[model samples]
Target: VQPSTFITHVAVLTQPSDGTAGRPLPRQPVVAAMDAGGNVMTTYTQPVSVKLNRGDLDSVGMVGTRTVTFRAGVGTFLDLRIDRAGCCLHLVFEVAFGLFRGFSEGFC
Candidate 1:
């Protein structure tokens, strides 16, 4: 399957349903985008200016997810960071082949 476009410099805030409270926040990390061929397409070092505050709950807390989009090519990789309640999280994923194939001799 073709890799989805890279998503960067965006924060996705989510809330849990366990009525739990988290700690203070930290400095946000930069976002990185990768092309389909696994090349660095772009980087987002701008600090995200958005903030989400969820009051103490019995089973809910806010969670953030960032995305970076890039043009299609061959392979892909991405780096993301999330800091909340004095905790930090990082994620990276590699994209393999895609669904669509280029024009070949027989098909054309």
Candidate 2:
């Protein structure tokens, strides 16, 4: 029998804030799952923490982007970055057969 191939999917969730100073940071948790043919194979959840400082405008403008890769019968690897608008984050996932690539936006 041939080895199973890996696939990846990404989703973005945004929460609007008042942009107030000295306020508590926001928490955005994301969950992802994959199914092969008709069988549920894998599931995972990622918790994202974002903090905005009062005096740091440049840092506040930066958005968080993360990439996750899962291997068959193995664990997953994650790559994270904080980027400003107009920039993009790239992710590459390697499988038994080939490679899959994906990108996420920095725009809020």
Candidate 3:
């Protein structure tokens, strides 16, 4: 377990990575956090979620996941299929603790 009030060191993009875009992208953006020790904290399992909000959560009409559980401190945005958003889409990963999160920009 992590110490209370400890800050996460980093957030890494595991899917929908940089320089990869496709119509109807059949993958979800995944973000993982690493402690100061640089190890995957599997015990950090917590319900994680994110969305492709363009100033509106439901603006895209199911283009991204609404919620997904985390495994080994990794949360995946399920059913994330983007094709009509054009470019420069944002993917935010929210951890269960409500203190740690990550963001990434991608194209579709």
Which one is best on lDDT? 3
Clash pairs of candidate 3?
Answer: none
Give the alpha carbon lDDT tens digit for every residue of 85-106 in model 1.
3222222222222222111011
Best candidate per TM-score, number? 3
Clashes of each: 20, 0, 0
Q: Give the TM-score of candidate 3.
A: 0.62
- The digit string of per-residue lDDT tens for model 2 on 1-108 reads 332243343222222322223332143322223324422234333222223332334443433343333322222332222344322222222233323222222223
Ten contiguous residues minimizing lDDT sum, candidate 1 = 99-108
Write the number of the candidate with greater TM-score, choosing between 1 and 2: 2
Give the TM-scores of the predictions, in the order they appear: 0.23, 0.25, 0.62
Model 2 weakest lDDT span, ten residues long: 98-107
What C-alpha lDDT do the candidate models reach, one value each? 0.27, 0.30, 0.56
lDDT of 3 by residue, 5-69 (tens): 33373365655632333344555566665666665555676666665545533434334456676
Each candidate: RMSD: 15.3, 9.7, 4.6
Q: Which residue ranges in model 3 land beyond 4 Å of their true spot?
A: 1-10, 17-24, 53-64
Clashing pairs in 2: none
